[model samples]
Target: MSTLKNEVTAYLGNSSRIAEDWANYINHQDWTLEETIENLRQMNADEDVMVQVLMLDTMQGISTKSSEKTPDDYTVKYDGYYALNKMLSTFGNSENGSDVCITNSFTNYINGILSIGFAVKVQVTGVDGAREERERNG
Candidate 1:
């Protein structure tokens, strides 16, 4: 049995056949155990992101705007960020000073007037060392 299959079966208590099946699937996708674990960790980290929507109860507005970018690609020129910048710019301001805007709605929902308050929490991760190492190695 492959080491990966053995490991999977040991951790999941799956039958040998099922373990092999899963290993095959994972291999076919060109995904390693390390990458899978990293992806899972990223997903868990994402869950900690809190999105707040504060507005007057009488106002009928929806904040369906958000931007998500990776460490490698985060800028106004990026499509997601571009859209967010454009939309937020309509309100005469877009400088929240937050690293990631999970989601937000800050304009007029009912009429053409803006009237709402919201909170944006920022979580910053330092990848400079990792990025520098990668670049140096490359």
Candidate 2:
């Protein structure tokens, strides 16, 4: 009976170690948004994909709101706008690029999804600027 009890204890200990290793491996896996979207596409069909996209976008908005302002905000915003402008010019160039219709569609799609108000919130921190902008715009 003692030998059997010892064997059972050893088995349980090994099982616990295996579970811990599995959890660690899962935690260390690098995940990306594109891979996640592809996985969802494989798992779900039709309207489920749209639902997942909307859910992700909403979660992004919430996560963006949970962060406090840092000094790097301006740098990031400048880089983003600069890259966007470059892309627009490259893709929309009349002489050697795609037509305006495609560019306009892409622009509208980007504008529809991007929250300019959220950008303003992140870039404008002071109470005075926020109040003035609200008063002047609204």
Candidate 3:
């Protein structure tokens, strides 16, 4: 195994199932393993968090492989840049659950501080608008 692989395994712990994938992903990134690890640490990406992210990546990969099939409820669009920006933002400031307007600071952080090289389309579906009765009550 490579030094990066070994170091990542040690960091994530022996029990991590996705350690190999995580290590490979890190290795392929533009940043060094140390830089990646530092960024992950800043994000508080513990074993559980890393596992969840890896699982999300796996799901996204599966979705891409089966793109010919109709998208099921399990289908997901992976956008790491968007995810990291959201994580860096203050909780509930950027649309946490229901889609809402984003603050200027949030926008600046995502575009300026993060300097993400790519763009992502975040579609919010299933918003049928408030019921007539609910609207009248307001």
Each model's lDDT: 0.27, 0.26, 0.28
Instruction: Give me the displacement of residue 103 in model 1, in angstroms.
Output: 48
**Candidate 2 TM-score to native:** 0.23
Error of 3 at 89 (Å): 40
Which portions of model 3 show Cα errors greater than 4 Å?
A: 1-14, 42-44, 47-138
Query: Best by TM-score, which number?
Result: 2
- TM-scores of the models, in the given order? 0.17, 0.23, 0.20
Q: TM-score of predicted model 3?
A: 0.20
Candidate 2 global CA lDDT score: 0.26
lDDT computed for candidate 1? 0.27
Ranking of all candidate structures by their lDDT, best first: 3, 1, 2
Instruction: Give stretches of model 2 more than 4 Å off.
Output: 31-138
Alpha-carbon RMSD of each model: 19.7, 22.6, 19.0
As a whole number from 0 to 100, the lDDT of residue 58 in candidate 3 is: 23
Give the alpha carbon lDDT tens digit for every residue of 44-93 in model 3: 34432321111212212111111224434213333444654343233223
lDDT of 1 by residue, 19-110 (tens): 23332333334333234323323433334222122211111112222234233321112123344344334322344332222223433322
Candidate 1 deviation (Cα RMSD) = 19.7
Instruction: Tell me the tens digit of each residue's lDDT in model 2 across 1-138.
Output: 999999967855653443334323322344333333344345333331121111111212111111134422211121234444343334333343112111111111111242211010111112332211100000
